[model samples]
Target: MTDRPDVLVVGAGPAGLTTALQACAHGASVRIVERRREPFRPSRAMIVHPRTLESLRPLGVVERLLRRGDPSPSARLHLGRRVVSTTLADVALRDTAFPHLTLLRQADVEQVLAEALEERGVPVERGVAAVGLAQDRAEATVTLRRDDGGAEPVSCGAVAGCDGQDSTVRRATGIDWRGRAYREEVVLADLDLDSDLDAGVLHVAAGRDGLVFLFALGEGAPWRLLATRPSRGGDAPFGQPGQPVPRPELRELLDVAGFDVAVGRVAWSARVRLQHRLAAAFRHGRVFLVGDAAHTHSPAAAQGMNTGILDAVNLGWKLPFAAHADEPDTMLDSYERERRPVARQVLALTHLVFFAEAAGHPAPAFLRGTVAPLLAPVVPSLTRPTLLAPVVRLLSQGWVRYRGSALSSERWAGGPGPRAGDRLPDETVTCDGMRTRLHRLTARPGVHVLLARDAEEVGASVVEDCPVSVHRLTSRPGRRMVAVRPDGHVGFRGTAVADLTAWLRLVGARARSADTATQPADTATQPADTATQAADTAET
Candidate 1:
């Protein structure tokens, strides 16, 4: 009803809500639509990784999440009677503030995000579904169908398809959701257990039959139980997707798994078929695909929702700039280029975990009863924080970089710390008699410029001309200047003010004069439409 917003977000899940929140923070008017009249009551995605916590900090929802969620810093894997526990505290990266996984229900996560959106005066429009989409050079038109048999046409500068796997917007854009669904069916239930289980550690019980995972929801909430149906010839007993598992069958599975817990008060239950799929293209003209609409896979490492949240943050920061800029396509093109590769990497990782879980079913009885117990002590070392640094980095998503992105440039060499395209480390520093973290200063709505020692002598002119927050840190022993993008990734790093100014001008920074000597060296070859053309070619 508010005149067509600058962006239209389809679906009010975490991804859609995050997209809307970030777009609004960046000074863009946004409207979100969801087919459901009410918020989801059942919990879907539960584990909040450390990197996701960092991404959520800018939106002002990370503290709320931490307040409501329980911290899970370690995990215990039970192979028959043998137990192997590993703590994440030792392996947690030093640059990040959050060192452990937070466990909160999906519903709670969405509620917190919705409250934040409401505080900003952007309420989600419920009971409305985007049935069709079309776009031209100027704007995108979205066709909406209401539950009350009313249809409306809305126009906006861009459309963000944050809708789930069965995305209508993705279908309208003619992008293929390519992948195969796994044959194994997963059953999930939330219920109270009358047994002794540690609430701080994620408990996984593996046997010759199958695997069962127990995640403590919170203080009062029921525990979430996920089990893979034992293969008994062909097909699972659950008739269809979303079917509630019978109480008797649930008990039978627990009994078979050797758990001596009494199931009480089933709050909710569901059966789901996992899939590994990724859309061929994330953008089709003015409409962009995000979250599950862009990529979906097994929930092996709890990467689905975390990856989706990052996707929203990554695209959200760029939408407003692209919408209002003269050459908007350049900014829009980087969305796919930077995000698609991350999605591919996540899909591969989840697939690897899923197959590894499946491979554990055929272990001999002796391995489970005796040999597994003997190896349990050594198992923790195999996954120790020091030994598995690379794998842990991948799982935490801390190593995600945009080195190949058009928006990134590392022209200066011989830097001791982070480079362009790498995530800026969150270091603590004193500014104006107040101690603050680097991310706290740079995680605002615009670009951030950090000037180290001799900042006044190096990049004073560039800092004056650039429209970003300038922070001078005299305590650091270096002559370095770094510009961080809105999404917390370094855009440019160097010691010369002229080079910094040239790179800024190249990226559409406001320049005081046309004849500034800081213009890019390759300005002649790099046309404004070069990035746009490359994006077009890649999508096709």
Candidate 2:
């Protein structure tokens, strides 16, 4: 190992591991350290959204994750006496390669990422904790405390704080964490149920009391249960945090959830006190917070772990590029600008969903018991694959865009494809005389230029300018040239080869000129919601 790694990741969760993986893949020397001695731990997150799978695909671990997780399962929603069956399987997710949610344990995800790191020769230094940090103009010095009561300071070009809510790296930076805890506590468990519930179907019920979900995720246990237990004001008697849930309590919960199921055994259970919070800042000089250290919210839409993974992916590829950037901090600033707003949006969405579904107020109760039952009949029509396209696009986080960030500068007219800052949506194309998907080109390490026609015009100068690669698509022939970033985002799109050269140079690429040309940015950028536009015409 080198004395000073280009990047130092301070935790070993999905975010930290991903940061290490992506940074290393992009030619950055990396060292990942975790406080937990054990390589793996049980995780609260179980569902990996489609967008997350897309982000993880380039890392070469999605197949491993799919092997351990369940995908495209049907769902049976029970609203009072009405049972509305729907299929989450193959619901209008044509824009993505993995169109369904992957229900796997968080431990399984971390294990896969950790093993991927090991294969890359960057093992996680367990039992080492980042206790102190100091950054100068040159590099950051992190004081680490090992398990054997030894302490030392290591220097690095940048630091990634992917630790969870109570993150030492976040605390070391003294960033203000602002948010509140919900009075409600949710009891989540993996159990063996002696009931006729279909093992391949997810069951959800919302009564006047609250909402409960049961899924056959097969992570440790065959059945996973999430029941909302609203707080009864002050000093309310409830079972302990990690205690075994008794049979009577299970019966009461099942009755409240309108499920006629008998619990055979509880494989594992925990009473989770939900909280909502966001760091006032995601970056403190060279110390950047990620994952739960940056944001936390209820698992209403399952954004917790997925959001952190995206955070790591968004920042990972940028760290190496920023090191040689003309304005290094300017490049890094986009991390906070692009991510903080996403956290705010998630907090608001989860808060609204939590309040509507589980709040103690009678208004929400009326909505659940009376309003929901009346609307149950229309649920099937709403969940139809064609009708469900919008919801899938939104919840899968396929709609997230960085169009407003400093990095995304659109240079062409509203194209028939994704705009700058939007993810380079996966599409079928002819690459190297072989039928393959578009991601096969962008998945490799470096900036990829997709040329629909002329391959000779790109020249060797562009590739030599930076970590750039050129590909001439034998399909999707048009007057289009799109430059995909390392993180699978469309950094530039235009009709002119000269303009593509200018983009490479503007983004810290010292383009040695075969065609020294410059063009003004397409200032008339598309509207804020690029995903909606892409979904409408993504197939083109």
Candidate 3:
């Protein structure tokens, strides 16, 4: 216990907790530290997209989250009483287990992750801040400062910077955080509403005055109200950063926007200036950046927390492989290559949406009174089910992939399906006597190989001392083998097992000769039957 843990995660938010949970699941000892003395109680990031839900299931917290959160099947856009547009239903998502967004408070998510970490014997160490960081070829050392002012250094095989925008770990690593802050400020408040708005749909309203977002926070929680307006000349009620909007001013803004809702109680409120930024690089030797530490942008589309969770999942599985000296550096290098592009895409998308919303200044009196009503009929077409699918897919992050990553090898050809660097599709298949899902079989710790036939016939072999699981699929087309990483992305796909064996060797998965006696003789072949049985019994 005194020795350095395999991974040290800074910031115990969703990103950090997810990294810890994934690391622990990968059989790596992990320690998570949070600067805050207690867990976050506010409902900061509230939407859990379907892709994120799919990614979290492997960490074992999705079911708990689904139980505590409300399913938002669709969203709606309103431009006052003149026009209202509803998004498409969940019909577009036939491959995913979760077809809708889950609305849960950020605090509840952290709680579920913390509980899971506890169950795995890894607890979040609160009130401990990483004051400094230093890394060498072998490990990274972090100096922690307790609330009482005592400072101590903890060494780890690697460090994950999941801290917020102002990250101490990032500063210690001296990575450049380049980005610009917006002139406008946003107001966020959780309010008890008296109106009869549907709790199952997100409502967004835009006017010449500004933009307003209404998100339901489950059954008992207060609804979240987010608004963005131009900053006033001097000290305004809500435009100033971190300022709390007075109840009277909040009600006035809503009334001006034509929303006849009574605000009973303000549970939480804050004004924040949006920014678009990304770290120059996500990795600095053994120290890597995840979540907000790597990128920050307007919360348009609620991509912040969800992207961070994906970052954790992407980097968590690679840490164990990179920790060993014998393993090739390609695994670690692929992390940045795969994730930085995603951050770039999310930042660009959110920035565009934020600015577009900002430009929707309050409608002119004439436009609101006459023009808007005349154009209301045409607005439905713009927001039709088919038209909204692309937006929904982007927001849900279902299309995100690592097609450009080094680990994505497509040397082997396959049928018309997901290729290397893409997420493994969720499918139901019967193996042995049980009917199970493909995701369930590969959702566990370590690398999973899905062979089209028997492992021995396909030449699928496990590397000595490498954590690999080979699962056989009797139904897949062709004689192809797909190796899925711990994070669920297809690492390699081909018809020949030699290519698979070469990739395992490249990632240092080959077994050592000295340990051959202790290893299973049919380690590669046995998984075929076991995976078939697992496929039958695996939970959907």
Candidate 4:
């Protein structure tokens, strides 16, 4: 395969593509082979979370996504005729620069990623299936079969599997997949619909027939309908592949949900069972796994693709460095440790939502009639934020951080009280007189700046004295500046430059003396200037 590409990636999906792109960005040569001879046919995961947006931004495609996708205003939960709870998209995510979720086809997101990857000079190779892998400490040899019955072996220092849940990579490595299979299956469809509903709203209703969820696809496309299983036992959770649900059958189902059909074409439909699973380990010798290759969970929170893409991003930058680095080789372990807990959290939360709906919660009808209207005003609070700091902290994507990571050390001074796994907060900021998201300011594949009130004293001499563009932040500036990692964790706090010297040693970057950093002589602050060589660590 072209004289042995540097990295052999099996699969061209979001996970694999992201891995390839990230690896390329780090200056590693890569070869990605896919069985599917074409791009995705339709939008699968239609919702892009803010964290995913952040990941895409560094690749220079976020604005394109925003321009092409529909901006969903909020997430609403309703009972038959009343609304039980409503989370305004804007308010719920006010903590994130991208406060709202964008509704777009998964294919759309892939297209953007694909273009960006090509522009970066690493295009994916399609129509070739990776059938086997053989890896040694020195290199990983990948076997590929072309559509024309040709075979080839490509060698690389490392191999990353970004394949889906039933990933061949997981099987090839022989890692035990551990998790429970959900009992319920869901029938989902994306299609055109005639509606008077607002384009930015996600409507969820409980009907006498079952539970129904409708999300506006865009201005004129089809709406995504997720209906609960009917009592007749005909509508199982996961639909069979050969037997298709006819238009009339789908119409009847909609009618039972109290929605009047306006006669539109169905774009896509499928039945999928909910699964919560994870690999026992994400790393094995020279082989590693990211995205769905490592974990799978229910889609209640719409976090699967988003989380997987992030997995690609997080592992992407690290792999190149680790592949070339020497010694302990402990850096890769952090991937599993940091991500496993996140998977568990996603599984739990998604299961919670599914359980609530399955139990009929406060009953769908009750929610639609009585709860929805009452909660609509608060919907903004529930939906919009710079990142889904609360829910995502578990998944470690959005504002999530890992203070106790391999890269972080507790010995650093003036460290915040946040723990190893906490989501960093977002602050409004103005750089160059152009007000922009704090997240937007952080250069890709690098650290973010969290300028604390004491940042001038503690950070000035360390980061400020360096060539890196560290945003100056205060606890209560017109906005806050929290230094986030490439993976979006708080790497350093600029609150107190008094701790500058200690932090520099921990970050492993060479820096000038701390003489440039001076807390006012009259300033009465504790001697946070503790002498320690540990790196600065923080919560997500």
Candidate 5:
């Protein structure tokens, strides 16, 4: 690295790549580093929810992923040979353009994001790992260690710890990683199966040990198998990493689970170690954690990479703005405010979801075998597409509300539509003389101000040292106005001009009376509302 960049991302996985891509998209100089010389091309995480796709749209990676990923797929739940199926289409949300669930390998996601970053002239330095970190009031310095015994110091305005479970950046912060690893090991393999099973359906069967999962979602392989290897000394000889997982051993587990599908070829196989962990603090001084560096959970809910990507999204928009603020520390604290709680909630949510599938083989022998057969007919209904709608919605994360956040302010806060701290769903609108979705207006970086056609007269007064894009609503009629944050959440919503200005000012937004903005807004004629506005918003 030469001159200091705005951000230094220390991992090239989904989280690190997304952090670099998004920070670059928002006009920040970002340098990303990866310890591994060769990319982890394995199909580790094979699921991408719709909300994650919506969040990545601004970075121009979602469409590429959709082109190469499977959009609609059915899942088959096998309980003692009685199979019940469900399709993602049945649980699709009508409001979002990307409603259906998508299946894409984690490797593909990293590739698309890395390519996008390369297009923006941000190169990912491979074979370079951040071994040491030190930060003061000015900037953060990181020690980079290469594979060939080369070491150098790289400086950056801030360091994003996209590094995984063993994060050196996290260690530098002295934040305790509070988590535990599962006793049972998981064997991950991409297998070619010889069976009549639908190629587009995901298969999972309950066994005396744990759930046996077979996925047919990858672009190349037709099936990827995830099965639990009972604690050491079990009949299944799926040993520790680097130990060979024989095809007969895999067959032995499948036979006990009643899956008669023949394993044709073991294209790729690895013994996976499962762990659950979350960082004590997501931010420490100039060092911030993202992805597995911040939190790691079981892949049962497909939340591992998606949650990391969400972590990156929440931190990406704020890191770029921190480079310009006078009070960078105070400016960055809100990132934890808005996101830390969400991570905590996810940690708890995924913990339960992970065990719901009996992962790690924790269930008793009777429940795994005898009880499953007895309840086969009734238990399968739990996976019915209609009933899974709420589960799907929860997994989509579109319903996540940040109403308690300081960035969210409500005036008498009662309304039928979205309030401050709520997600801003896409709506039809025209831009540049062409009809487009509302979310498209944010293809560029900065805060987006959505104003009713009638409110244009008052919208100009809303200015910020930070780049702000203001759009006048012409497709509909109303006096309501809303401010959409860079992370796609509503910061403020109201109809009064004075109230909106007060919010802008509260959020460190500058007021304009002349060619340039005045720091202390001339509030001589401005009338402030008691409830419509309160607290601060994003800083420049």
Candidate 6:
């Protein structure tokens, strides 16, 4: 019914909405199309990991998410009659300001995000679905069909497919879905129970029948459920709510698990299998895919939504550059390279979860009984509250830093630099004596100015000609003068003003000039062998 926008998002879930918000925040126009008439009625995703909460900092949603969710301090695994392993969430991520996991319904979180998007002036368009997509070198033409059978075409500079598992965009682009599917069927229900279940722990029980996972939803509420079928699938469990429950089925599960129930109401129930899949590439020309469309893994670690939200955070900054800025085409490719490896690692973790009950493997049993519990005491020493933490930082904050493509040449130019796979910390800086978080300062899609004590060594003569801004590093300057990218990375390093100018010009190329044939590399030469070099390499 209307013309195209700067970008077209094919889903309105967390990933899609977050991508739209991030892109628009950087001044790019966007439109979102969703097949669903409305957001899901009840909450689905119940766990938001600490890493995800940290990622939400830049988006300004963590405080809100924490308010609406319950903090899960720990998790315990039971083997038959014994508590085999227990990992403290707080201790596991001890080095972070947000060290504890939050348990909130996906529905609630999605609703908050949707409302936030609208508040920021970008609303989700319900009752429309992407039926087809056509892309050229410059843009993606997305075709959407309305609920009433009307059709409209949108031509966007870029497209992000966050349309869940059965994504039409992924199929429309002919991208291969490469991953395994979980055969297990899980039955979930939200209920007001009668027992005194602790709100701080996620309890799991492994039995001959199947496994059951229980956690507190919030004040006076709890989520009780069982893996209806074997993780790999064989037979469905007893007590199918919509069907029938043997007299002993419900009572036995509750009695053993200590579910203090008093004839409560069942909010909703469903049977679904887990899936692990990823697109061959996140970007196909001008059409890019994110969240479930790009990667799907088992829900064991409860990382599906977390990873999806993170996908939004990752691509959120990149899409605007690819769609509106004069950035290089090679920069877009970095999305696939950086995120794919992460998805693969996430899948591997989910796979490790499957081994918890390997029938013939005694090693798994031993690990379940020993190594896991030991992790509790040692978790703290391994972590630190650094800027840009790692995925492994979940074990401890020390794993966080700006080490990969996430860094900018400015930071890599020998000033203070952020390591890849690390968390970006929001330090308070006084601009005109107005204090604000570093997160807010770098929000714009361009180079960041980080001035440090060592920056003077790089020599202002080399960077003075740069187009980016400069800030001097003072006491406790996170690092020396580092120029960060629009995606919250260091692009150039050193206090030298000339080097800053050159790096900015090198990275500020337009989308139209992204092709090698159009814009050749500048004489500035790439940042070599460091985080800045990697980030520049990511862009090239």
lDDT of 1 by residue, 390-497 (tens): 665678788899988877878667768788989888777644344556665554455666778565443333333223556666566677888777677898888787
Q: lDDT tens string, model 2, 451-535?
A: 7855335755543324676666767677678887777788888877677766775565533232232111111111122222233
TM-score of each: 0.86, 0.88, 0.86, 0.76, 0.85, 0.75
Clash tally for model 1: 0
Off by over 4 Å in 1: 72-74, 84-90, 199-201, 218-221, 230-241, 324-326, 359-374, 380-390, 430-435, 456-467, 505-540
Name the regions of candidate 2 deviating beyond 4 angstroms.
218-221, 232-248, 454-456, 461-466, 476-479, 495-498, 506-540
Off by over 4 Å in 3: 73-76, 83-91, 194-201, 216-221, 232-241, 324-327, 360-387, 433-435, 454-466, 508-540
Model 6, span 177-267: residue lDDT tens: 9877564545565655665556567777654444567776532235555443444343432112233333244546655543445536555
Score each candidate by Cα lDDT. 0.73, 0.77, 0.73, 0.59, 0.71, 0.58
Best by lDDT: 2
Report how far off residue 499 is in candidate 2 (Å).
3.9
**Clash number for candidate 2:** 0
Superior candidate under lDDT, 5 versus 6? 5
What's the true lDDT of residue 112 in model 1? 91
Q: Tell me the TM-score of model 2.
A: 0.88
**Candidates 1 and 6: which is better by TM-score?**
1
Model 6 spans with C-alpha error above 4 angstroms: 72-89, 92-96, 199-201, 208-210, 218-222, 226-228, 231-264, 323-327, 357-392, 395-447, 453-471, 476-479, 486-488, 506-540
Residue 496 lDDT, candidate 6, scale 0-100 = 60
Clashing pairs in 5: 507-537
Q: In candidate 6, what residue range of length 10 has the lowest lDDT sum?
A: 512-521
In candidate 4, what are the lDDT values of residues 1-540, reduced to their tens digit?
Answer: 246666778877778888887777655677777787887554446677767765655555666677677664565555444454434345354545565556777777777778877886777788888788888877788787898999987788778888677777789889998887666556667667776755567777655334677877632345777765522333333212223456776677676666655648776675665567878888887788887778877666677788888778777756655543333265567677677777667767777776655434447546544555566666556543433446543332554557667655333345544432345444454443433444444534444444544435223333321222344443334222243445555555433443433444444322323242222211111112111001001101
lDDT (Cα, tens digit) per residue for candidate 5, span 1-540:
347888999999999999888787766788899998987557678889977976776566666787778777777878786877667754636545565778788888988888888887887889998888898978899999999989988888889998887788899899998988766667777778888888778888887677788877543466778887554433332122334478888888778778878988787676766677878898888889998888877676788899889878878877776655544565588777777788787888877866655554446555766687777677556766667667877987777877877667575256556799888887666433445556555544556666766664444443233555566666656777787776778878887767766665444443333222211111210122111111010000
What lDDT would candidate 5 get against the real structure? Answer: 0.71
